[model samples]
Target chain A: MSARNHEQWTSPPKLAEGEWVDSRIYSDQTIFEEENEKIFKHAWIPVCHESELKDAYDFRTMTIANEPVIVVRGKDMQVRAFLNVCPHRGNMIERRPSGSFKEGTPSGTPKRMTCMFHAWQFDMKGKCVYISRQEEGYQDRLCTADVGLRELKCEVYFGGFVWVCLDDDIGMTVEDWAAGALDCLAPSLNEEPLEVFHYHKAIIPCNFKLWHDTNCEFYHDFLHYHNRITGFNDAYFARKNSGFKNGHINVGSFEVQYDNYEGFHSREELSFPHLPPNHWYMIDMFPGVNFNLRGSALRCDLMTPLGPDKVMIEFRGLGLASDTPAERQTRIDHHNSIWGPFGRNLHEDLLAVTAQGSCMHPSAEKRNILQGRHENETIHDENGMRHYYHEWGRWLNRSPSNPDEEFDEALIAAASAKPAEVQANA
Target chain B: MAEKHASTIEQIKDVIYKSCLYQDDLEWNSWLDMCSDDYHYAIRAFSPEIRADMEYMGGGLEYMKSLTQMLPKHNTDNSPLKRHCTVYKVEVADDGKSASATSSFVVYQTMLDGINSHVDAGESRLFLVGRYNDKFEISNEGVKFSDREVRLDTRRLDKGSHWPI
Candidate 1:
């Protein structure tokens, strides 16, 4: 009921080990580097949607764990990913965020990703098609066959998203890694081809995991006035928060009463295929990705960690590719009312996580972040974050409650174990 | 004829400046008063990543007023905003009943007591830079905004604002 002194404030709370985590996991530089190596490199990340590269030779470039990556659509209608670095001098092959190699550039021929540095050209399959003056430069030492781009493991799944993994040896497919977390939206998203109607990104000054934590739990709905007005009902409070294997979580569906908010109307007319009117569902994947479906529109948040205290979040709003112009406009309105930059709720989330980042700076005093609320694993419970940090600890082999200590397998057995429902689905 | 046209342009400029001032001061009532009952407002930007134009916010007058009324109940940054605008072109109708203007604007946010104020207090950061495409209805009473579209150039809003820019 009162403020504590320094000693009392710094000590761990009187809670179970898995119910709390050390703040250093969010602020330490070493832990951030280890996360890139241990967690992100092996995880299947949905870099972009397939609809983005509908035309032949169209491509998109992004970074995964600070390594430049390019995803392209070939003439054979296959999508492939490769390291955007050239084999000659390690220069970045493509500088633009997105474009098509279908036309001839000033330095290279058509239908090829040409490195402006040495004009080394790579074909749609990432095969080295041409090396400028190859015989004159290296004689027999090097040939075009020896200098192909390093291709990454790529797949198109879960509603036509282009998923990529940095580790070629990673044994899990995107569906296996999902572990039933995305099953809730599978029917709706897979029912038809979806096209992204809106796109924007923000570079927030916060750890990437912090943003994921906000998405994993609904306890912070109190911070969103719009949600309070439209969604504080019995169904909302009773929505189950289910944790799946590999740190994934899903919040069960509940119909939103959009009419409760002034100047807002029900979105029943444009609900996704096979979805009930005004129903809301969410999927938080392992590491940092979120998919939120609010009846009419789908919002996907893809996070790329930039530093210990910075992360870049790309937000996209999608609707059916067959939507009429009027239908698409309605879906965009539904999406922007709550998820857009000037939406009623999104900026509030950014405000809170950035504040957490400010307090948890590496130089600041260390403390415990409690995730101990237990409500039969319902909407307001904190089990989602607990499950996430448990998996995070296992990956880095460091204790969540005490990062200086080595992780003990027995400490978080309860949180790490898959729920019976998840096991049954698996 | 030239003198009368110059006077009409000056009136249009005054309306644009006053609108910015009212919004920057958070005087929602005054800002709304300068808008017609059918006022349409929107904020838009083009994203190269998606290769499309995006409308971040849009509403009619009633919708905007309702959002403003809910602002106090929401969690928002308290940083004060100051807008600098330059009216570049104003074209008046032959009947003097309507006009259109194009103006460039830059909004700066001064830290007061928001989350990052501990380290960024008293500092002014460039919040957003955009061009405003505006339409007005001129009358004997005064000039009022009929439509305004804010086309922004800066896409990355570090800590985004609840208020429209």
Candidate 2:
């Protein structure tokens, strides 16, 4: 209750080797609320794969932080996103999750998006094309020109994945944010259009951050009982720290080199059908999304907070665009086997995260983030948490206690300092 | 061509029961023997809500063989599962070479603690009731499945077991 106590809560612990994380971050309501606004609202979020809407008029509707948003391919086949709610009455304009409508279709027929609530209609460009009560309600006051749906800044990444940003001041573009992580994920596509083999959405009884934090750590592998069966690599994946100018962090995992660890037969003996023996990487976004490219197939998980203790997680499977029907099926099967909501590995993570939530009650305040890696491997020890919290602190307008909080300044300096590198890349 | 090779209604029902029994009894080798080298098995779940696309969770026969071998290490702390399958309807192909069978199943997962248990039971909601839309290739070599699609109705899977349902 004291000002000092409040100050302590705001300031993250100093970055040091073998430092432990306080488990309170997962359970605290204040921290959760702050993150929802600062991270989820401000950071760029992955809406859908571009392959889902390849042709013009292809559209998909999704909600970000409960704000209805529509992703569509416009007249020029350019992908764009807009607020899914109608500007006139706040009713959802798009009914289905995904579909295609003709470029210039009349409202209420088929392709036209007609709001069931008021019969207000919008064109593919989200312009108010038709209004049933146009002159009845108000004569000249109704400005059809100003009634276009609110649009969001959307951009497609290398692998047909689209990320949308609600924050106008987003400092980093998709390219800068991805860095070299994209280089690793790009090959997973195998030059195939990303396809959703099996899509799963689970609303679990736990805070969203708790679930997000569960995947962020590597220490929990021992907690998974299945690790005993499938056999785990003792070769810890080296975690490197990189961030986009907009504050997304690239926590890339080095290639895992496994020895003959006798757990689930042998890794060599029962390996995945067509995956590389020693390749793995994951890129976690600032708020709550992790794009993991495992072997030849890619897995994208987006964790969104519905409430203080309720989280909705979506797991998407992506395969090669040019894969044979059978080959694509095989890729999907392998992808789901290891990573689906029902898959052995993912099930354990769900259980573990739920258990963490159970233990991190409000009464239990003191917590530790077991980042206690050895000195050399701990180079980016608190940097992951620091990088996230640094952005969190900046967005929330609260100064972090860490004296070395120079990520923002460092970003600007790097931009101006490396004129040659920037120009060359540009 | 696939419809021409489907087994009879009765034969299809028996095959579905035998496949479950083969898994329940831990006759892993026998299960492998059921399918020919060109055989394929897919566990798929399709969303009536999301277009006509289907998502395959597990596929191929060799992978199933590997999965059966790997199940022991990953058995949950909960009690081992005992599956009870009941066939409700079987529609045989006119040629009697292949058929589609729909079965209602109640899987009882007993816990090791002996204090608590869980049961996943469902009927032919037309979606979840896993049906063996089996295409048969019957020559002198006896009956073998040319293609088998296990369509499940339950959209969300809590724990995916390696054992075939």
Candidate 3:
């Protein structure tokens, strides 16, 4: 009941295993690097929406686990992803974040990804089309056909999101990876083509998983005054948190009473196709990706882990591509009111995670992060995080509650067992 | 006529300065008083990454007032914002009923108290840098802002603010 000494403070909580996680998992540099190798490098990450690269030869450049990747649309109208490095000298081919290769640069040809370093030209399909003086330099030893940009496994799925995996033989498509986690909003997202209307990114000082954890659980809704005012009814409290395979989690939908807040109105008219009026759904994919659909607008958060203590989160807001100008404006208005950089809710989430980051630094004392709340898997329950860390442990081959030890299946099994079974075991 | 224009410009400059002062002081009601009944406010930025112009936030006078009034209830950064503005150009309407002006502004935030206040207290960081494209109505009452567009050059706001910049 009172403040404890150092020995008691450092000990684990009274909850069963897998009901809590060690702070070191968020602050350790070695574990951060290991995550890049075991989880992110192989995961099918949604790099960019297809609408961003609408035309042939238009490309977007981004990074996954520090590896620069370029996604471009070829003349054949196929979206492809490749390593941004040039084959000749490994120099990064595209320096710009995004642009069209329809026009030729000073050192390159038209419709080609040109490496300014050595004038090596690559076609939209990643074929090495031109090499600088190939015949004179090495004669038959080297040819354009032998060296090409490394292509990655890419697919446009789940409502035109361009998903790419660094590992070519990962043996699972993006749909398989999702494992029905996105079924809640699949109809609405796929009902019509969507185009991004707003985009912004923030580099928060926190582990990438911490951001994903926030999305998986609604216990932190108390921190958001806007949500509390608009969504504190019985239905909101009864919303379920469902976990899927591969660490994905889905929060069921509920009709948000937007009229509860002053100057706010219902989003029924502008809601996405097939969606009920004023409803909201959220899906949190493993290793940090979030798809949130709030009736009128769709907001996706894509995380790129920069370091143990830093994560760059890209936020995209999308609406139907067939929307009229007025409709699009209304969607943008609804999106910005709660989820924008200057919105009523997002800043509070960022503040909460940043505060956690500051205290869980590498030198900070170790502590237990409790995920023990059990409210029959309702919105406020912590079962989502408990399920997530179970997958995290399996992938990293380490324990979530005690990282120094190997992962133990019995510990997690006992922790998440039924109340009667847990009591019997005790 | 030249003297009248000069005095009008001075008054316009005073209105611009007072707007920033009131916002920095968190005097939301006073800041709203400086705006006309039909005032429009927007914060915008050009994203090179997406190759588009994005409106991050926009609202009318009533909406702005409501949001600002609800700010204290939300969890927000307690650090105070200090806006430094320099009015660059102003043009008075031929009828002398309205005017348009552009000013450069840089906002700095001093960390006062938060989770890491023990270590970050007294530290100041550049929060945002932008230009204000403002339109004012020169009515019988006084100079009131008719429209204000904050075109920001900085896009990445780490732990962004709930309050307008």
Across residues A201-252, which tens digit of lDDT does each residue of candidate 3 receive? 9998888888888988899999988899999899998899888999989899
For the candidates in turn, chain A alone yields TM-scores of 0.97, 0.77, 0.98
Q: Pick the candidate with the highest TM-score.
A: 3
Candidates 1 and 2 compared: the better one by lDDT is: 1
Query: What's the number of clashes in each of the models?
Result: 0, 20, 0
lDDT per residue (tens digit) for residues A73-97 in model 1: 9999999999999999999999988
Residue-level error in angstroms, candidate 3, position A29: 0.5
Interface RMSD of 2: 4.4
Taken over the whole model, the C-alpha lDDT of each candidate is: 0.90, 0.60, 0.91
Per-prediction TM-score to the true structure, in the order listed: 0.96, 0.75, 0.97
DockQ of 2: 0.19
Which residue segments of model 1 deviate by more than 4 Å? A414-426, B1-4
